[model samples]
Target: MSLSTEHLLGIKYLNKQDIDLIFKTADHFKAVINRPIKKVPSLRDITIANLFFENSTRTKLSFELAEKRLSADVINFSASQSSVKKGETLIDTVNNILAMKVDIVVMRHPNVGAGVFLSKHVDAKIINAGDGTHEHPTQALLDSYSIREKLGSVKGKKIVIVGDVLHSRVALSNIFALQLQGAKVKVCGPTTLIPKHITSLGVEVETNLKKALEWCDVANVLRVQNERMAINYFPSTREYTQLFGINQEILDNLGKKIVIMHPGPINRGVEITSDVADSDQSIILNQVENGVAVRMAVIYLLAQQIKR
Candidate 1:
């Protein structure tokens, strides 16, 4: 089955069937994107408005590229340069944009539930790029898609997400996605960086990086979200690195090959090292590549549901 919802709001709202449909659709787009002529005519008549309230590199570029590849007319709106700087409310701003006949709205806002809030008020279909610390559904979709591409299957695979879970939308979304696909999920990092009651999602928390690495089939490392931290959560970056950093030494210590994954904008020596990120086992780049196709699948599916 395809996505039943009008908005790609969060992974928590999705079931295993939704995820499977996205991956299956992505499989076709993945093949199409790899071809010499990558553009598709499926969304040629559709228009997408990318509204980003937060600064981003990978997600923004990936979405724009995916929309372009799907042959959709795209408009990008950054809050920093928009009328939002003049105290314009989000609904007013988006409604103004939608007045131009945009069919779909993909947004990244710093406020949690911003997408959900927009969906309730807007006529255009909403896609949450990343909404505060709530969730990044498409990122999790591409992440799981990349994992399945690499490790062959997600069912029963052990995956540990390491880093700032307290402020990570990626972590929450990933837990929902991975667990839905029947993967065993774990979180490892400094205790302060992990939120209380995350275990209610059915993942264990391991404070020790070594033990966590030893236990998982894939190590999905996360970067310290310094911008999201209100105050000092840990003593220092150096101390945190000393305790949880993944380097060649750690990789060598692992007796078997374990796939390493990072979302993006990686800290060189903090949660993961340069050597480890560039290692063969690291599917970081593949995740970035798969992001385009996965997003295309999402946009295509959602575009089909649009009345326009």
Candidate 2:
């Protein structure tokens, strides 16, 4: 259940057994952590810096907690409030930090392949917290953990990931992880939002919200990317709701067996209805909780590979 030191570049880097191993390892780690002594000597004296180019509440804090739980010193950097805003290039800023002899870099950049770029240029081990609609490997890992924990493994589960398919790194990552875990993955959204040939990744594509609703064991809704939406890719919020929103009508169409999930900072009535988000079947909260544990597992496991 252990990964190599090659770096978790993306979900494409991991297979089914590898993911299951992490989940199993996390489960065991949790049990061990419940004891009177919660600390682990595995990563003592390690240094992990969190470099975020974009704002995030869940992912940022999760990574920090993960490092602290392993007894590592944590340094945080933000693009807006840092020297990067003062005419420093990403590379130059990162080099300055790495000069301090940090053991690992956990980065979230708005640039695709930013993590991969840093890994190529740095001595310290790197984990991609996220990088611009390209991939969020840990989000996918935690989502997989959340799904498996809630539904008792993903094998044969008919899971439908709805909304902003093209813009969601979480969707892209989860599609790979979920498919690898033997689930029938489907992505549903309007034409502009859901790209063509996405099924080549081995997931089904659907545009009809109603049909996608009935076919799902889990409806994992996504947030609309207001930050990235330009040229008016969507007609309007009202129209988008009419076509793609996971509202009461969609919820009514979905059977009681279906579990609803949303990555947080939801757009409320647009992507998911508030009622469904707060319902018994909703694992949105669980995703947030599992996110911390999954990240902890990633940090705990990867810290051993840091060569510090």
What is the TM-score of each predicted model, taking all chains together? 0.99, 0.95
- When summed lDDT is taken over every stretch of 10 residues in candidate 2, the lowest stretch is 248-257
Q: Which residue runs does candidate 2 get wrong by more than 4 Å?
A: 32-38
* Candidate 2, residue 130: lDDT: 82
Q: lDDT tens digits, residues 1-308, model 2?
A: 35754677789888777787778877866665566976666677788889998899999998887677678888999888898777998778888998987878889988899889988887777889888988999998888888888988888999999999888888989889888888999998988988676978888888888888888889889988978766677879899888888776667755656889887788888888888888888998888877766877877777666554
Cα RMSDs of all predictions? 0.8, 1.7
Q: Tens-digit lDDT track for model 1 on 77-100?
A: 999998999999999999999999
lDDT of each: 0.93, 0.83
Off by over 4 Å in 1: none
Task: Judge candidate 1 against the unseen true structure and give its global Cα lDDT, from 0 to 1.
Answer: 0.93
